[model samples]
Target: MRIRATVAAVSAALALSAFAVPAAHAAGSTLDVTFSSMKVNSGKAITVGATSTVKVKATYTLTHPSGVSVANVLSGPVLYRGTSAKDADTQVVSDAPGTCTTVSSTTLHCSATITLPASDLYNADAGTWKQGGVAVDAKSGVQKWQNDLGTIPVRRAAKLTADATPEPVKKGGTITVTGKLTRANWETGKYAGYATQPVKLQFRKKGSSTFTTVKTIKSSSTGALKTTVTASADGDFRYSFAGTSTTSAVSSAADFVDVQ
Candidate 1:
């Protein structure tokens, strides 16, 4: 991480104009940030079911709204937004401060990434970095050069896992399976950078001999899938996630439905 301060790089004409006109102070120009690669590694992609150890790189280029360029530094806590779940938060980066290293007098570059978990998927957005001391509104003036982030969609190691809500649902009503197809970030393109396997939901009526396919669905970007089933006979139902080898067992021992 390079943190060196560069001289203000706005053009002489712009600087003169900024100095000549007091309103220029209030009319803060927009620093638009664009990315090159939002990947875990610079050029490589992590295969499904494998752990990713690459640091994500984002090549960012900043431009002013007025076209009169000025150089500025950006840093601080960067939050990567994922599906709405609380634990779904993937911290792409924690905290590291890097200043702008200008390519020319007018251009600059910088990068940062937070450690990612092995089972967790990765995806993030390029937004204005919030500097602690700077007011929220004023922070927009600073732009961190962005790289198109590379994602390491990690596949879960082959194993047996079960996901269900309420453990076993009430009989005569419904049972729900909160399923997820989790893998390491695999594939390519937009959604490929993250791991969210399409979920499979199978069920059989209570005491039924064979389990039947009730529904198949994919987890949200955050890896969440759910299914609800009603029991025909009071007993036990057997079902499992399709594709990968996984299963869940629930006993609907209660014979009657609870109308409430």
Candidate 2:
């Protein structure tokens, strides 16, 4: 649904001309252009929050025969969720052609931005996505696609909170810890409860820097968490989520408690 002008124009031409021709058959054609050193989002996971459009930068090296004039060529990187671009279930393409700088007589380094709108994405779309490159001759209508250049993880942003009751409690007394787990909902453009997920209760001593897991508990149907712990010492309590393929890992800020 986030298709851009360059992608739409090139895709239409490729469809009509059957642009899947292999590189070996591009002897005298503009399809001889090849892509290398392709990288998306600087090789980091792309995390999207509700309602915001995420733009990631992609860079690659393009090599072409000296005889081919690249002035008429449109090239950029794309992320897809299927075997190939033409057969992709969903794909994200750059809004414009890549800006290239000459590296040599036969090679150029290029970079472009791929925009992703949260409203256009589904929960199932969060996972490993294949990276590929596409090049099209604007005038000749010839195109070339290189699939499986690499992979990137696309995940929804997650959030967690923790609060411990009775800031100052007597030793051996019972303390209640409560929190919530939520994740970005692309469809509704909001942060919704992530129900029935396992979350960890962690404790860190006043003088220590490390937090040790005290227990693991599952969230309620509405993503609420509540547990009881014995107040033994002065420390901080927090919750942690390991995260799923569709969500990014997150931890809550620690709530400090004093034992009398």
Candidate 3:
């Protein structure tokens, strides 16, 4: 009787083990990349002229769904472009390194770095900046990473121009104007990738002598700045930012339509 009972117990234990489901992998969703700050000149793209330095840093968090190994590769070089057009108009900007560190069985951590070229950040390309955003090239190999929710969108809005639809304003009305500023990094200069001094924006009437001081804008963790101000009266308006020895170099005039 003892021998028979032992055999039946062993058989029942084996059967239960075979029927049980395997454990699921603890992978999370897609990767999440974000910038802490970014900056450029108030009017121009880069500060400190061609010799200026711009520092940019981003944090990347990778989430997985299963037990898949992600290749230790970084994101591509993104551009700081105007709002109007895309493609070739989009210049290739610098990026930081990307690496994966196992935060948990289902979570991973990584980073990206970018260094802007010298001349590209200094002068205006003589193009209408309708909008401003970032872009990147397709990864060299087949894409392994996919967006789980909406966490892994390709680009973020760095800066943007006012919309085509004009906002209503009373003639000679007091209205607020705001914008962000980002100084450029160096391509071929003494101080490269280091931030130039901050730039100051001065507002004025297009054809009039009257000028009013508006708020100053600075860069973000990604190297961009935004500012806003109110107008004393309505007319053709524009802004100018000249470089100080400690601040960014001169920037081209930016304009806005003031309506009655």
> Model 2 Cα displacement at 19 (Å)?
13
Off by over 4 Å in 2: 2-30
Error of 3 at 5 (Å): 77
TM-score of 2: 0.86
lDDT of each: 0.34, 0.84, 0.34
Tens digits of per-residue lDDT for model 1 on 70-174?
A: 533343223233431111233333223323455654444555443333334422212222111100113334333222233333233322234444444454666
C-alpha displacement of 56 in model 2, angstroms?
1.3
Model 2 per-residue lDDT tens digits across residues 1-260: 64323335334323233333343454465467999999999999999998878999999999998876787777878788888853576777766678899978899999988878898788778899999888877666667778988999999999999999898999999989999999999878999999999999999999999999999999999999999999999999999999988899999999999999
Alpha carbon lDDT at 255, candidate 2: 99
Give the number of the best model, judged by lDDT. 2
TM-score (C-alpha) between model 1 and the true structure:
0.29
Q: Which is the leading candidate under TM-score? A: 2
Alpha carbon lDDT at 202, candidate 1 = 54
Q: Give the TM-score (vs. native) of candidate 3.
A: 0.32
CA RMSD of all predictions:
16.3, 4.6, 21.7
